[model samples]
Target chain A: MQFGIFSVSDITRDPVSGETPSEAERIDAIVQIAEKAEEVGLDVFAIGEHHNPPFFSSSPTTLLSHIAAKTKKLTVSTATTLITTNDPVRIAEEYAMLQHLAKGRMDLMLGRGNTAPVYPWFGADIRQSLPLALENYNLLHRLWREDVVDWEGKFRTPLQGFTSTPRPLDDLPPFVWHGSIRTPEIAEQAAYYGDGFFANNIFWPKEHYMRLIKFYRQRYAHYGHGTEKQAIVGLGGQAYIAKRSQDALNEFRPYFNEAPVYGHGPRMEDFMEQTPLSVGSPQEVIDKTLTFREHFGDYQRQMFLMDHAGLPLKTVLNQLDLLGEEVVPVLRKEIEARQDPETAKPPTHAKRLKDKYGDGPARQPKPNANRGDNVTGGSPYQDSE
Target chain B: MGQNFQLVVVSAGTSDPSSTRLLADRVAGRVTTLAGKKAQTVGTSVVELRELASEIANALVSNHIGPKLQKAIATLQRADAIVASTPVYKAGASGLFTSFFQILDNDLLIAKPVVLAATAGTARHALVVDDQMRGLFAYLRTVVVPTSLFASTEDWQDNGLNKRIDRAALELVALMTSGFEKSVRDESWGSYQHEYGSAGGTELSIDLDSDLMKLAAGGSAGQKSAG
Candidate 1:
């Protein structure tokens, strides 16, 4: 299993100190955290995308590209790139460009953004969220795979002979994982496309995601992509660790009580018992994480939410250190030993490139010079001569 | 031909000997007797919100139903008909009553028969059943019986209360024996929209051939541009 951390990019006030970091400070701190994750041997560092206030990561590709440039081994990605509101054409081009800059050290998880008003802000309707997501993704899929695309959809203007430039690095689109908290249609979409399905397993009970993941796996096999065991799956979790369990809980309680999303709600102890929020020692985190395999079956990736709720940058770095040193090493061994031999590994840039074009030159589109209009040409790019 | 029916009674009373529970049981008992005349055996199950107050509150905060609440929801979903009773407080329905229904899947009670009842300390709150409860159940799309039962302090001594209770029970029985709820749900299931992420609750089946799914596969001919 690949282990990593994902941040919601909340600029929360430190409850204990009553000091909130400035936007610039928080942004720099996240970049530092990403670099530290690589130094500690973590596999991935994903950031969330939010367009509203108190959230710094409205643009995930820019941040991910910067992180990728700084780290060689650690994969940079988005916790969720909003597929509902973003134009699929822009997503195709921007991510393809990022792939070239990162040299294929990137992939993305797509979600219908949680904020409702964001839809209207982007000139979309929340009532048509599912249709928007489904349609946009269909267009995005074609943009990446096909050299030149002719497409029209209900949500966007028509694209005739539109070639999304920078045509993905080495002719391989970044592997996509659809992330959802509760929607089954999303799971069905992921399964139908033979893509990965990621469940935000932190806020809800295990039974909730167990049903979604099980449905995705069954449908993956039903769609003739692979056996149920071979379907790719990922889960998001939350944890806070210290030497003693009490210390961890005591330290995190103040932040837990005041943080948004779940603050002033369920108590920390009850939340931990009810959801996947683990607050304890390194061993406790290990024990809690291992139960995930039993609950959701053998999965490919496991990401944790460690940097949100106004925790300081130093504390988040410490949590990463414990994860890389104590938790992931043991988890990697234990989970791998129990993994079914038929189960597929998580997709990477190299693996996808090899799968698409084995021992052959990858496709490179050369645009025909200055055709005033693309409508007159049979093809937008020149293949030979 | 004799058939079995599931009747669930939800009582949102805070006291141990609350008039709300009394009213619910009275409705359930009368409905069973009236349905028996039509060769239908009614099996009754009661959900006392007073007993599940903490679990309901926790579910509100955590957005997850506990085991006891899940069991109550399951019991309600299996019910062929329902008798929903609540005690009015501060000129409105009890918070416990509204909270329980808020957590329910929107499609759970679609086209199901329901008898709305409310108990208040005074006769002035009589319209709580029609004014408030009917609107709530209407939003859920339940086929609430036209006759609603309201019990006041003096209603216990009035013969009119018994007449209204019997009338409501008769309406519920008539609706149940006709199997109108099941037929409507089966025939017009596609017309009702479901809340997202309700796959585990009332919405167990999905239409794979929906227009959205077709578009996801690939858009229609109009969606393909001419090159």
Candidate 2:
């Protein structure tokens, strides 16, 4: 099981001060949140990309690449890579490069994105989104595995001969998860390719995510990915935890009520009861999150939307300390103890690359001794030829 | 026998008969042999500082790279495969190479199969390929081949280097010919229109007499629309 935090990059008003963070303050806060995620023994921290107002991350790679140098052991990924809008080639190369820089600790969650204007800005129509997502991802998948690609499609121009470089480290590309909120089409896309399906279960109820997960598992098996249980799965969660349930609710309530995504929509208590959002003690969050496996089946990665809602940097950091110290260790132990090796396999970078390549371990290298001495032979000139 | 693939080698070494270019040629030769009659090769040597100096000294400031450069760029843009070889300088790719990279058409290398090769003085410099070079390519949105063939003088003297190159060539051929063929069903159906989509006209049409008022007032008129 992987434990991580994700942010939507919203600049929120400080609950205590009633003052909103400047864009610069919000950007710096995102960096601090990511650093804290690492300090707390978390395995990953993902940042969402949104180009519109109130959101800061226009370039996720620039942010992730910076994070790659700042921390070790924490895999950085995009909450969404906007498969429908960005060119598949750029995505393939950028992440492949990050995989090398991060030493294989990179993965991406592809989505059609939440904003509609982004489509037209990228010269794509919203109506062709599903087809664009499907076609673009198909091209991206090949780009990572194949050395040369000759692709001709409705969305992008044909390639007579094309090769993306520099190569991936260890001959393996990063793993990918197709993220979906309500669209069965995205789930079907993930299933068709036998890739991981991330059901962002935070917005919907368990029953809704269950159907989506079930559909993916069945179709995953249909595509011969693996047995239903073996299909790679990850879930999304939103939480705000404290040592006591009452304190947690009191602190998070005002923030939640004002949150642009869910604020003013449902009462905090009703929202918590209906969705995967846990606003209470650490134990309560852990327990509520653990029961999720029963509804969606054994999952590979568990991510929480903690840094959203304009929580101050200090509070978010404190929440991470509790989640990592009190929550993740327990989840890891429980998930591991319950896992059946015969049916359950933790997702690994190598496994995903093999799945994508449609082959066994990348071709092995052979040595040649005929060109010996010249290998070490110098410039053959010492200022006198 | 029916498969046709194009090989583009991007070399960034300054010296004529440079080791990096030699290594690039060897890789290209192996591909040519592997693809038999169906393979063609396009090679570009981007001695960056020199190109930049010339561009800076002349009216060529338009970032409008020439036909020869465009032909080399097309190798990356339109080729089925690429073998990019460069000499390591200060523990990273040459500045010349990076500057040329800055001018490449956006997203031209996406999904294209690429083999990375580098020639450095010592194995200690291997990090140059893994860290800096690979890092730069990722920003450009290209899929780098996973298995790289790195050559150091010591390995060459011990006769261990060429063997790796051979293996790289063979494996690269298999990956490109099989996987790329399957991924791309048609070779010439104009899929690249989106990538090479009109980059606005590069033609320099400077009409000083046309309308100075419209040019100067254009700024104010735009603000008025916003008002």
Who wins the lDDT comparison? 1
User: Which candidate number has the best TM-score?
Assistant: 1
Identify the runs in model 2 with alpha carbons over 4 angstroms from their true place. A350-385, B1-227
- lDDT string, candidate 1, A86-169, tens digits: 999999999999999999999999999867899999999888898889889988998998877887667688887777887888
| Interface RMSD of predicted model 1 | 3.8
True contacts reproduced, candidate 2: 0.00
i-RMS of candidate 2:
27.0
- Candidate 1 docks at the CAPRI level of acceptable
Candidate 1 Cα deviation (angstroms), residue A52: 0.5
Runs off by more than 4 Å, candidate 1 = A359-385, B33-41, B58-62, B195-200, B221-227
